[model samples]
Target: MPNITDEQLARPFELKHGEQLLMSSPKLETIGSTINHWVHHRGQLTVYMRLNDIAVPSIYGPSADDRNFS
Candidate 1:
């Protein structure tokens, strides 16, 4: 999406999978919201990984998988 042209960014974002009555944000705000939503979900998954004793992958920096992380 970083490759998206300025013209593309000027276009309004559309939702195809949900109720049409839902409000929409601008393209850039929608992109930011989507990224925040993903990070929120990933954090939840990491909690699940901890409960199940599963290794969590690196996100912002080195994770437990890195030999020097601990």
Candidate 2:
């Protein structure tokens, strides 16, 4: 992560991403988007763990692996 001040979060910036695409958004918007993307992936990971009979830590609520996380 880079050093970002709260004042800068209100300002827009461009990110040169893969495939030569440029993403433009306010810092706060980008941060929220990044977090949402990770959360989506994490949900998939939990499903994968369940399929493999691996214990999954509680994220939002209790799972079959443990009922103490609600």
Candidate 3:
């Protein structure tokens, strides 16, 4: 794995699958809330997440918050 730096952890990102770039945010909590709200209203749907300022690994698939999973 490549070394991720603090600078990299401070940048906003978008989760991408092929050509599609999903929601971009610097805060994971905000992203989670947005996704939860969407699901509550629109039913369950798969959404992508991009990490900003941190290296989030693949969970189930991949996520910016995967590194924090305990």
lDDT of 2 by residue, 1-70 (tens): 8997889998986787666748789989988999999999999999999899899987877776785644
Clashing pairs in 3: 9-53, 9-54, 10-53, 58-62
Q: TM-score for each prediction?
A: 0.67, 0.67, 0.27
What TM-score does model 1 achieve against the real structure? Answer: 0.67
lDDT of 1 at 45: 94
Q: Report lDDT (CA) for all predictions.
A: 0.82, 0.85, 0.57
Q: What local lDDT score does residue 25 receive in model 2, on the 0 to 100 scale?
A: 91
The alpha-carbon lDDT assigned to residue 5 of candidate 2 equals 87
**Which sections of candidate 3 miss by over 4 Å?**
1-4, 27-70
